[model samples]
Target: ITACYCFGALLLVVASICDLVSSIQLGQDSGAVLSRPANSSRIFYGVMFDAGSTGTRIHVYTFIQKDPEELPVLDNEMFHSIKPGLSAYADMPEMGGYTVRQLLKVAKKTVPRLEWKRTPLVLKATAGLRLLPSEKSQALLEQVQDVFDESPFFVPDDSVSIMNGTNEGILAWVTVNFLTGHLYAETRETVGILDLGGGSTQITFLPKSKKTIGSSPDDYIARIDMFNSTYELYTHRTCIKYLLCHVIHRPPYIIVLLYTPGLEWRVFKSSCLPKKFREEWSFGGLTYIVSGKPDGESYVGYKLCYQEVLKVVKDIVHQPYELKDTSVFYAFSYYFDRAVDAGLIDRTQGGMLEVRDFKKRAKEVCNKMSKYRPINPFLCMDMTYITCLLKDGFGFKENTVLQLTKKVNNVETSWALGATFNHFQNLKIHR
Candidate 1:
């Protein structure tokens, strides 16, 4: 609802959107919304928990109604996260519940007691839980749901669950575009989004070519009613293709999953690692023996790495799409982390770089692995994989500029706010 709370007509979104809710909590005193104090009753709170694979995070959003009939504002946000996500505690479900309860404390301290009952508390799980069997994932969700049930805040229906990957991408797209003020403009020429995660990667944008939209599969289009206008987003299709394609090898997908388990004793070697480097990496309750070629044929580095990752890039079915025509793109998660790890951009003040920048850096990191060593051995592979994904998988032009942002307007670049907005609209909550 960037252009407006544009989804008034979206409540009956689709058959798949049974539990969806709208995020808006407009005041009953809607008579000519004027600037009010921070303490005004119009100011409200939304509590969202991101039950990600690596960790669970809490985002306490403070929203204010500045223009009841126009754009909404996310005035401020209080954020916190802890490592070892709920999935890590899958065996001991109660421990997973403890994590949820701990994060709730942050919400408790942030939202006022008087408004606690009115605030919407939600938790949306990403791919981490999606990897688990349904029974295991359900146990974890049930554990968190127990915590929410006991909390003082208003828990909407199906407040905690494994989020659909399509919804996940859309919500993240909404978070970045909405915060950047792309939604408020008249042109509505919104930027596309690129997220390179372990199990999945998402590419989303408004198609400039009707042929592109028409050629796409039915699942490619997400038809949502926003205000009176309808939007058919093709993110779901792109994401599915990209994720499946990238799995041709382990390096691209495994290293990207910072939260998944790994084989302890396997000396997995890849051309993507610095040729002379070998190290033990541990995370998510497991260890991995990963190393570079160390000493192999000289024909090892970016070229070999690229060819290996290229298999995954081949999975995409394309039309002369508008990804490049969209002008700007936003890449986050591993894209930002690898960029920061490679010294391509600042961790705090994330900067923009062309899609080819990753290619150039990958060449440097891989070709001269013996000369230049990175702190993370996986850097070479990640950089190479990302380069291939953007240039080959998504079919982005070399000159296309990608804005890498970890946070927007001081709030973490998160999809929870969008989900909250979706929930807000879906619930049609009455104060």
Candidate 2:
């Protein structure tokens, strides 16, 4: 009868988790089967849907509570994803809901029919829907609610909603910490997270110094109560895709583009891109025409690209007190992608690197565009942009080493797992 639900920025199926926690804590010696387990093992499933900007994903998590009074362990996860996220159907609310319906097929097949009525279903959306018009966003959410109501799985209150930016950072921090064993160990030591997603990027960690908390912008800090302790984490979100979108009214993608003085061209050029590269890119439902100047005999490589990227990051990103010294950071998403594409790390095993490692590779890639061109067209731009982002954007020193990973212990290093953990704590499960 354990149940939970999720659909949003990350996939989370926490229904069974909440119930399992509740049951374990409420367990007492009694003749009733509800008060004590009739058997030694109890198993349940949770269905989570991640309605992201680029895609919609599902995570069907099964957990086992070995003892009646102990915490449950995640047994397995069945993950799947579909393209063209709900945001793509901004004008077609019903179709967005239909996508949810289609993903539910996996849930139906995964969870046993005997437990279907008791299994909980939930969905949470992230930056994608958050960027949409209010009317359009609500229409899509309402349609999904209708689909949930029609499904056989247990539907909980607030089953569909948009996740705020702050929670996104906090949960991701929790996920990495949990996977790294920092959450359960005796030590408070935890690694910071640098996640660069398509729409936005986040920086989060448990601040060691009180000054770190005091100096940060009020909104950048979040208070989290977990494992019987409270932590004030330094968390913030910045629009890494600032130059990609042109909409002036959007909240997160806000940017002030600087142009060359008295340049007669209408296009905005970046040294990060290939000098000869000219193409149209689309983001947030808007298309932008961009290209690099090929004719000019200029060194528009890493050094110049670094300066240009600095314009977007400098004087903006808040430097954490701990970042100045030494700290471990697990950079993922675009960070991992670019590193693999740049030959800095193995795509499957992943590898560690210093912030300057990225810089060195960026310089090499940007200078020898022709050699790496066939591997990936954006190799130069991506490598250079990431280098600038880590060094200039976050103000990390060249020698600052980051443990870049896409997964830890087989589970993905994503915000979803941390968010799932929070779901139970938020409910205040007690015996």
Top model number, TM-score:
2
Q: Report how far off residue 281 is in candidate 1 (Å).
A: 7.5
Candidate 1 residue runs with Cα over 4 Å from true position? 1-41, 66-72, 237-268, 276-290, 294-297, 317-320, 371-374
lDDT of 2 by residue, 1-431 (tens): 22232221111222333432331122222211223234536566677788888789887766555554565555556778898899889999999999989999999988888777656687889878988899999999999999999999877776799988778878888878866777665677888999887656789988888888888889988888765557788999876444443343222222233244465433456665567777654555665545565766375676776677677767767777767775889999888988888899999889989998988888898887777878975676677667777776777888888998877766667777676666644542222
State in Å the error of residue 189, model 1: 1.5
Say which candidate scores most in lDDT: 2
> Against the hidden reference, what TM-scores do the models get?
0.82, 0.85
**Candidate 1 at 70: error in angstroms?**
6.7
lDDT of each: 0.69, 0.71
lDDT of 1 by residue, 76-142 (tens): 7788999898878878889999988988999989888977877778899987788777898999999
User: TM-score of the candidate numbered 2?
Assistant: 0.85
The per-candidate count of clashes, in order, stands at 16, 15
Q: What is the lDDT of residue 355 in candidate 1?
A: 84
Q: In angstroms, how far off is 342's CA in candidate 2? A: 1.0
